[model samples]
Target: MYTLLIVDDESIAVRGMKQGIVWSDLAITEILEAYNVKQAKQLFANHQIDIMICDIEMPGQNGIELLEWTRTHYPDTVSLFLTAHADFTYVQKALQLGSFDYILKPVKHEQLKDITGQAVLQWKKNEEKKTFSVLHKQYVQQWEEQLPHLIERFWQELLGERVLPKSKQIAAKLQQLNIPLTLDDQVLPILISIEMWKEEFNARDEEIMEYALRKTASELMLASWPGTVIQDRNGINLLLIYVKPTDPIIRDEVQKICEEYIRYCNQYFKCSLSCYIGESTKITEIPGMYSDLLVMERNNVSASNKVILANEQLQVRPFFDSSATSFPVMDWIMLFELGRKEELLEQMTESCTYMEQKSGFCKEDLESMHTSILFLLFSVFHKKGLSVYEAFPSKQLIDSTINIRTLEQFRTWMYKVISQGIGHFMLHAKEESEIVIKTKKYISEHIHQEFSREDIASYVFLNPSYLSRLFKKETGISLTDYILKERMNEAKRLLVQTEMKISQIAESLGYMNLSHFITMFKKVNGATPMNFRKKIQ
Candidate 1:
């Protein structure tokens, strides 16, 4: 409801408005009458006045002075000026002082009524927003002061250090504060966190970033959960979502919304976004589930900004075989160095295909893959005497990190980076050859050491998927298959030339179990270890 304050020294004009205008029809709840500026200020101080309709000429304090004071102090209050004088100077001053409108003394009741109604409607909107903010602030404070203790108890019960009764007690206290939850009821919360772009933004900017993210999250929560999204708090905006039959669908909707929002931020705001979805459990279980989500997201820095459900699959697996497949890592390096952007983009389709295949990777694996690729690219850039920042820059780094949120984003970023400076990038292709050679050397030596495909990764420090693909591209053999073949040949040599027992040879070759050794040997050589030994002899 909007409250209007009418200030006029002329009694006749004030009576005319009160009698001629339908205040109720205009939706003005309280029509406060003030004879002078002092009385109007007193009313403003005491009550919530949305609009002030005052006479420009008044005793002691004039409407101009009153409007100026309201402009500074009661900025939320819309000011409307009234005066018998049709002075252009007064009209100009009123306009300059931020008055909503200035009406001459012989005010037309119809015009005055219509303008007041419009002002009232606008004021109501502003008032509602103000009311919500006040409520949000009050509750946010309550949650902040109490959440730490509640979370501590929640953890204790989750870890079995405390009992259910304690958890119930904490839930009861939250209910007392009108948060409205019980130990029996489940609470599903989406965990939102920001990954700073290497501290480039200052404190104020970071605060603004958090605020923007919170607003976006809040809007998404409203869209997805409607009334169930009670309140949000801190930099980590936890939306108190109600778990229902359509929850998975609801969560998916929320995830889609957040992904778009995060993409916008990356494209327009340049902030790194990461989100973790927690399971729907009893409200008391939120802390435990959230802790797990945080740990999962922390251990995996390359996750997307989408809301992840608690029980959702999250692992680091090979989503793309860079050796068997093609990615634009090389093309991008070449383009970035040579500045052949047009040609680089022309080669982007293949690279995008590889990144799109990364959808099969769990959130954790996707993030790890992102990290590994960045490190490798940085290394490649540094080896070629190019600055990592100069070639890729911080913004690109953030985009690449956030790009894994979706296959499309990944592809988009890959294309954008690949199409940078193609001709200039060819120079860095020198390291590609060296990286391939180093990878083979490491594998040849470490083949006898039970070297898994991933273990061969330390040689070039690329991701296992990337190295696996790179080796096959260069040597036409998978790293693991190559390692297995080498190990079998070494075993056959030991079996024939050295009087080494099968068990001894197995232990020497980093196999702990004799049966396991025989299985692997037969799998590779098409014969049992003993048979191979006899045949070799």
Candidate 2:
């Protein structure tokens, strides 16, 4: 419903028009009568007039002036002129004032009603347009608010191989996300590894402190450069600095900034962080550079609170001869037993890289590696109170150890077996007491089975209630939580390493209900099984 105002000099003219017109048929709910522009202005000030009909030659202010004022103040209201004269001058002036239509004096009620109906239709269209514009702006604002998160998600997918690494695809996604980056842009990946915290803190506290470190790095280290600091899935902070080819001194500048950031973190946050500066490459190569930096960080076992350049690490080659003397087997055993996997792997890689560079793999080199691995396996199993045969149940351990012919094959086998042995040993070693260790080992060994508190307690030879309390007191996590955590961790490993379907993975984790497994996975990882696989695979 709309309000209509009629203006004229004579009362009878206004009264006749107001009474004669069938306003209700045109959807006009209220009809206001005014003898002059002054009265019409007052009526307009009080009510929201949708349409106005006025006489052209009123005293003081004419219909042309009223139309001009209405057009300026309430442009949405449609105006029509009623006049005794059909003079060209009057009609021209009314049209110039933006009146909707010009009706002759002594107007027929039907003709006036038809014009009002048309005006009402136009008004409704304008209102709809206004509403649509408001809605469009609201949605645009919402998109802008969510743009940062979307960009982060896109980068996560790109880094995780969920999105293809082609330049065209990356550029298209950048445009869609409104990120001011392109395929041609040079991006340097700086891996920030938080080494040690001087203060004791819980998991949530550590997360908050890490977030603060990232924010500080963004503001203090890369303030002059355009970049973003993202925490990868492995909890490693990566700062991608976008540089131009013209900026030749950026690498040195970034190195200095990272050194300064390290000092600041040590001073203020009571934490030591290692910054691995990667070579600047095109945006499309960021994922590769990111992976390289992670490797570099892992190999940085002997250094902390320092800036290590990727170029320098790449340049490090084996300086010793592999055939001259065998590498220290006892040192490798010590590092492995100490759970220094990174240092162990780094030493092995350095030795192999040097050996391969010097004379390739010889019989002596193979014997030396085999001896060291055997020593490591024997010592590791002995400390855990297990024999070599018991440690490896699937195969004859000595037979596999004796069959290594090449350095490449030995290296592959070494990594697989060493990583598994260290992982298993560390899981049991984390429990402070023997009973807790037994409970943890049992949970790990039977992770695929649907076991309860009673089942685990029976396997560990303890009362269920006592075992639960002891496990919590020793490990700071309940037995049930420990089982779930182990299952989720295994699920993650399988998702990344294998091409098994989601349902199969869930079943392997002892989840009979696919939806329940997905819900639980999402609860732990913030992503479903399928999405998590996409992120890692």
Candidate 3:
């Protein structure tokens, strides 16, 4: 008899699985249920579970996380994942975590029984290895199968600086993982960077494709040398070839292998990538070589689908400037204000495209472009009276700009900030003519004060051009005309009702020069201020 555990967030589904499955047929007499990963972990702690059928999607912790834990703590327990998520990431993680089977849910009763019976059979097979020789054989077989992954992990840890990089520590780890290498051994490292993806893929798909690429590189490039391709903590792929630095033909072989590899990847993996090769160095010194190759990749913006060596003409130079330095940051403000959306975006795209295609453009170029666009957009937003936070909306969208990795990503973020900021300005620029009414009200309040259009604009918190354009567009009158009309009408009010002279009326209406005020009043009200007062009387 075998014990089994069913883990699903839906208690009803767990109940159904417990009641529907005939455990006796599969020699599984006991069954347990857990609502989530935490509860399932609790069940595992108490029981000697031989089989576990867990759902992949749960609230607190996912089935993959539980499976990872189970594999570490209870490797003998055969685990199967039952999940609605057919996501490639989940499937990949499940397999990597040593899950016995991945059964998609809404699985038929017969299918469940068949799968569960197979799981039981596998568990029983493990349980049957009771003799010391049989146990030893099983362990040896498992170790052999796991040796590659272990070695890869060791390399990752060593280069990632997670483990001690001393010679003794390194030699001990190499021996433990059965990797045939020593401190004196030299290894040439090459950095592979995915410049472009011809096909679209999610994060997990990209990871799997990277894995496939590494395996392919191992097959093609490391056939003659004793080496392997391992990924660093930063997700950078490095091909470590164990050979002497004095090997004369190694550089040529690296170039040939990289050329063929790039062609194969471009055709098969649907990606355009470049390989940056570094010189041979000691195993511990591989990290330094990897860092140098990374510098080459980061600095190269135009070169892709080719092999580059450390001593090449296009080498990593000192801190320097890009080809496109003088980007027109000032012109973007005018384009935005004029609502030239398509023209501005086209120009920006052309600039970034040039950077992507031209040499000497690097991470610093992308950063400069990003900074210029951000400054221009924010200046436009401030001029148009839109809040920066409201324009961006999501915090992540703005925060993502802090660590831009590629030209494409930089261009994408630029477009998002531009489209959102300029689009918002376009949407709200005309603003229901309320600012026009507000401007008129502020002018009326200070009609007697000697205030220019600048003062009124300051009061209304708008640019003078914005205040002027909006006032004219919405009120069908120029700001000067509107102010003149209001002040003349106020002069007329003082002319008839109050016992003030025409000169006093003009002066009270903020026209210190009475003669000049009369000329302006005559132009607006069809008569001079003094004449208009006599006519009204």
lDDT per residue, candidate 1, 1-537, as tens digits?
A: 668888999888788888888888877777889999898888888998888898989889898999998988888998888878789999999998877787876899999988887787777788799999999999999888987556534433443322235665766665654544455556666666554332233334555766676666666555655323222222234555655444433456666766776777677666556666666767555555655554344334234455555666555422222222234354344345556566655555544455557555355645544554564356445334345565567878656665457656665666555544233346555444555667667866765575554445444544343444445565666455566676778888888888888999989888888988898888778999888867766
Off by over 4 Å in 2: 84-98, 162-166, 246-249, 314-537
Could you tell me every candidate's TM-score relative to the true structure?
A: 0.29, 0.60, 0.36
Alpha-carbon error at 263 in model 1, in Å?
A: 2.1
Better of 1 and 3 by lDDT: 3
Per-model root-mean-square deviation over C-alphas: 27.3, 16.0, 28.4
Stretch of 10 with least lDDT, candidate 3: 315-324
Write down the lDDT of every candidate, Cα atoms only: 0.63, 0.75, 0.75
Residue range with the least summed lDDT across 10 consecutive positions in model 1 = 226-235
The candidate with the higher lDDT, 1 or 2, is 2
Model 1, position 249, has a per-residue lDDT of 37
Better of 1 and 3 by TM-score: 3
Q: Give a tens-digit lDDT track for model 2, residues 1-537.
A: 899888889988888888877778888899888988888888988999988888999899888888888988888888888889889998998888777788997899888888878888888998999999999999999999988668767777767663256777788888998776767668788888776666534455667888999999989977888778887554557787777776643678888899999999999998877788988887776776776565455334356588988766432222222223467544565577678888888888888888888898787876666666766676445434344554465453456656777777778877877787787777765547666777778888888887666566556544344455556666777565567778889999989999888899989878889988887778778998888877775
| Model 2 TM-score relative to the real fold | 0.60
TM-score of 3: 0.36
